[model samples]
Target: MKNITKLPPVVACCVVIATVLWLPESASLYAQQSTAAACLTTSRHQLSKSGKQIFDIAQKRLNAYLASTKTNRTNAPDEPVHTIPVVVHILEPEGRSLLTDFQVHEGIAELNKAFRNQLPESDGVDTGIQFQLAVRTPDCSATTGINRVYPNNPNYTLYGVTSAGGPGLPYDQVYPMSYWNNLEYYNIWVVNFMDQGAALAAYPTGAYSPFDGTMITASYFTTKILPHELGHALFLGHTFARAIGGGDLDLIECPQNSNCAEQGDYICDTEPVNQSSNYICFSNANPPNPCNNNAPYGTVLKNYMGYNTFGCQTQFTNDQRTRMRGALESLRTGLINSKGLDPVVTGQTIPQGISATLTATGCSGQIQWYDAPADGNHLGSGNSLTTPVLYESTTYYASCLRADCPSDARVAGLVTVGPGLPVHLVRFGAQVTEPNTVTLNWATSFETMHDYFDVESARDAKTFGKAGRVSAPFRVTSGISEYRFADTPEPPADIIYYRLKQVDTDGSYSYSKMVSVRMQEMQKITIGPNPAGNSISIAGVSRNWDIEVIDARGMIVQRLKNRFQIDSERLPAGLYVIRVNMENGHTVARKIIKSQ
Candidate 1:
């Protein structure tokens, strides 16, 4: 006789790291839970109840402009593409803003490429608009085009700046203090955090205002996001827009033949789409919300204005291009007519350079070695530069340029010739090993003023406590060192976090990037009463596998499938072998004795 119970449905496995959850087997659940709620909320409603009033006025202006285009008094067919000067303000908590120059440059470069249809991943239609970093500041002083602002207030977030029924200061109080002249430059605020989706942008109000820009999370300031917000800045609404009391998909009506401009998105070329708040179009073999009656013509999910993930979106339609151009020519002409523009050079660095072999990494442009960070003199250019032996330490900088556009620049780490180099960490990573142990590994090029490594762990990356510690060994000049620490906590959590605290002898300390490791449940079996009187019991058995009982001489006595308990009372009092085999190529065996 065998005892068995039906197995319940597996909920699937998940791993969480630094508040980000990865669900490989639960696509629907992931899509439902992870898709941002704020992405679907239109700024028209978030900013003000009368936000649509400005939009209506802009639409009328566009209609008037289209009507005038039919006359014989049209301008020349060829017109120089207009460029908008941009300024990026990075707001972060004190000692927490770790955004590198390369990251900022990459963000701006991606924006330009997307607009120019130069990005290889998109079937982009050129919008005939361009963005360049502002070369001059408000006072006409030269700038590198990037500004870093450290707000001493720890609760500073982009969303907190607006008192839109939230816990923060009002926009009028914050904008005037930090914003540039709305008539001259397009300002982009990259804060350390955002409560909304990846970012938010204001629509064109046909008037110059201080709150005329976009605010985005520094983490999600990617190629797709920048263009999407820029689309909003040009008065382009989302294709699947939802407004007040219009019902679902009624903010802009469903397209009917030639009335596309009057319907969804107000664009004649882009097909109408209505994605719900939780909809996500991931770039998998099967896309979410496949073509159906709701979208008989199929959704233009690749449009920047759609609520698709970064991977799924690729282009903007011709009508969107026309609309953006119309917004620029008519209602938003002030920006186009503004003068005194300058180029922005990002990734500016002030290095304490010395005479030694130096290598520059993480750059996507041509490398130019400079004696000074700016406007001094240029040295030989390459991916790496080496200096001759020197009696004293000297400074050097590197500039990364893609084509004619400046990408990023940084000072090489100080190169000490004779004594030794400071503790230069190369990389840090973590992995899971046997017996549910997590091993952390880190390496450094050299060490000076270094004390020890403090290993830290946290269940929820927030409350980190010390797990272990290791003292740094004495260092030698031009030598590399590696260290490892294995954490064997009892019954570790599903996700484990680790970080290295590099403390100096002088009590000053710095931290390495946080690394996470995932622990999976391994199978095990337990049996009781090896020398039983009349019966035996089996424990820790899984129903998804098969189990067999055999006599001592290897003769099969009994077999069971999807069974957890078995009766040994009928078997003769002798030694027997119990074997378990799993479908996933795992086998376990145990010896048992039956007694009468």
Candidate 2:
């Protein structure tokens, strides 16, 4: 990542300070306490300037849409939900800094909970929007909706920086390496933000820029940060943006009773808030700081758009929801209705003994087959795939061999293994029962000529080696035979893929469908003040692991058994990796950006 040079001058406005966080800074910037107030001001201002024409048009369209829906009452409980396809690009240093699948799953889960109003509060409104992991890619292949890139080019991480060469670069120059079609999918880049910013986003303005997307740091990706950024992408603004500039603007009324829509965030339900101070918390134990001039409602501290603490962010107003929906229907219609490429594999559910021919298409290059959706062992490479007699329901996918198109976007074919298959390979699956331990189970009915079953494992689908084997029944019978095997994975192993090889008495054999399980992380540790100045704080675990601070060259500069701060005041600005070695032999490493 490039070091931040200097921030360009931004026009002074009530929201001017709100946009200041995105400015480039050196190490000295870390010493200053950060205020969460008015985080959205900068983007809002930028959009209003660069996209004024489109924004006005979108506002008019939103008014019309809402007016039409006023009498129709669109949000019926039985109405089918609207879904927006999303593609996540995780740019980490090599594979060492990779965010785990479980983490991304949890992040998306939280996003769903917030959007569906599933959170524990009546104020949360269902935004009438659903975010789905894009199943198909631009070349029309299957995908897990997540793309991980360990870029060879270092320039990929300089987000928000312009060509003048500051600590960050514009999204067009920095993010195009992994971005999908902005029209078809909502692109989100999870990287180590150069500015130590929680996140940043671009608002919808009818016209699509290649740089149009949201950028968030990995640590903040799991919080309300997702919805907050999505809100910007969907054309919503901060609830208190009006109070950003100094004073003497216009409409700076109290929250108790005022012209809500015209005064503050342009939403009637959201009370006006003064952005002069940050609200650290909204709980009874630590209430928000007093509102400016003692406004009756204090502030709209609990709204997602407010600069409230992460834990306090809860809901969006009905008007905000209406505005976002209107934007989706108008400016973002391409993303809302896009159906990328087509189905590469097509077939219906069938019994285990049956065979189905699957075809791949829309790829300029060859195609490879995988049993699992994202990263599993490669089954084969060809224009088509024919299945062998199998047990258990399986999802088969085709991958486009185009170098530019690595993630799958083609619709995967689901072959349902019904119970009627005679092989009765009945059940075969794998799971992580505990840290480092994976349990494999399988059952067979009427063993017949079956000799033994070798439980095989692979880090990827292509490499298969025996973990252990279970003996088959000595005699043929109609009763079901159950078998289980447990194995402990060693260091650096986070996920294990397993399959079963059923060998017959005469040495004939058939492999079962692949199943993959992600290992539980030994411990979770978090490092704060990430772009650290003099020291960094570590938490989550009880410091039960050995800590090592390593520089870019893979040399450990400091080691400790149990300690909090890794003092780096004497060190120069650069990228560093903190490796935590647990007594259980599990090793975890995270990338940290240090400022100069």
Candidate 3:
């Protein structure tokens, strides 16, 4: 039995986390029997409401969303592709705003790839939402979507910014300086520093006055962050921002008894998550947290909406894609209709260390040169321009003379940056070897000031313990260093997260990107095992099980899929998430247990 209705916000003071709710502005709305309205109205916090018609529409959406969870339905294939124009504003100081045009372009590419479901490991559907660098300014002027602005203060940083309206914030002073038509373009501000959060965005609801678009921290910029923030702009919420039941109480999302559409993040396809940040890396095992509490278990993840690791944040669900598409056609039609992806000048690509001359032939006024596509560094004003030395690939945008009035779409020039040596972790993965043993492996591109490697494992991603240490190789093997570790001494967790603590000879250290694997998580699935985490026999079916006995840490301790019974006697006691491939070409992850 699924429950509907949920709490308004964090009013109940009993919820754990992900308790975000959009409350009405009206005091009486809660005064009336609006689920847990007594908590909200009784306190000073009164939900606001501007109109009743809007409330009715929201209710209808909630109801339809609620019905979506129980049944499975495919979205219409004829959904039109949505294209949005984007502008990234980079603020002052070289130390803080550490983004390059090539990186910005890469970020955009990642966003598109995630939306289109191009990731190989992901099982999500494509949401036809696409984004392109805005070729034209608000008044139909030629410009790249990237903007580079230098404020009066050298160490200028943005403070007091929120996702919604901010009346007296410093952004009010900065908006007039760097703002374009918010209705026409999706603006993004890349500031040196912000006190609010890593990134914040505005939803499609038109209710938040004076504040629009997204603001992100330069340090936290990634393919994952931009896509997530934009999801909010296109009518999406955090995966954890749901209640267990629909508006019944102000509680965080839980695995059991959830009304997905209304109470949860307003979507059904994505399984309910507990602490979103805890379940970041679920797919490959080193999940930040294996959260979903009920039917769908393990690290039930793949969507960008979850507060998971960037590597684990892959795609959007079909339901999420539909929601975004609807928002484009209905709520954000103006931005949709804008000439964002219009034709620009034939872009030029030059090799690294070489400068190129970009020419805009048909401009009626003097050409304004920019480093990025829309809102980037302003080079100078000229028809034909010479560029600076390029170490990395860069896209330059050009506009017309007038700051106002309609001009043609911005022309673009691209300089291809040369590829540099790979200095980061190439692969950090783990796999189960023989029964009761797990092996961790890693490789690096090249090491300069290298010393030794420390393998770290964590039950949860936050608190990691050093597993073992290995010294650096005598020399680079095949232009890379490969290392392996077999865990004879392991923890008793359902999943294990692993990362490499790379220590240079100077004692300075940096950590590699985290990766995870399932261990003893199978506590209650298919295998007939001890309740404490030991498998004894197969309960139902005998042959064709193809079961790999997974322990509590998500590691496959034994393989007995075809036969049902394996060396389950050797498995350690705990939970497990094992892959159960079925004869119907379907697969399921069931909890298994081993008898003591």
- RMSD, each candidate, Å? 24.1, 25.3, 17.9
Q: Write the per-residue lDDT of candidate 3 for residues 84-149, one digit (tens) a residue.
A: 788887775534545898888888887787777776655566786778888767666668788988
The RMSD (Cα, Å) of candidate 1 is 24.1
lDDT of prediction 3: 0.56
- State the weakest 10-residue window (summed lDDT) of model 2: 11-20
Candidate topping TM-score: 2
lDDT of each: 0.59, 0.63, 0.56
Q: How well does candidate 1 score on lDDT at residue 483?
A: 90
Q: Write the per-residue lDDT of candidate 2 for residues 62-181, one digit (tens) a residue.
A: 667677655333333323355777888887753256478788888888888887778775256678687777777877577888898766444445443333334454434446668887
Q: List candidate 1 stretches off by more than 4 Å.
A: 1-49, 70-79, 157-173, 242-258, 277-299, 340-596
Task: Count clashes in each candidate, considering only residues at least 3 apart in sequence or on different chains.
Answer: 1, 18, 78
**Which residue ranges in model 2 land beyond 4 Å of their true spot?**
1-48, 120-123, 154-163, 167-171, 244-259, 276-280, 285-299, 340-596
User: Counting only residues 3 or more apart in sequence or on different chains, how many pairs clash (N, Cα, C under 3 Å) in candidate 3?
Assistant: 78
Structural similarity to truth (TM-score) of each candidate: 0.47, 0.49, 0.45
Return the candidate ranking by lDDT, descending.
2, 1, 3
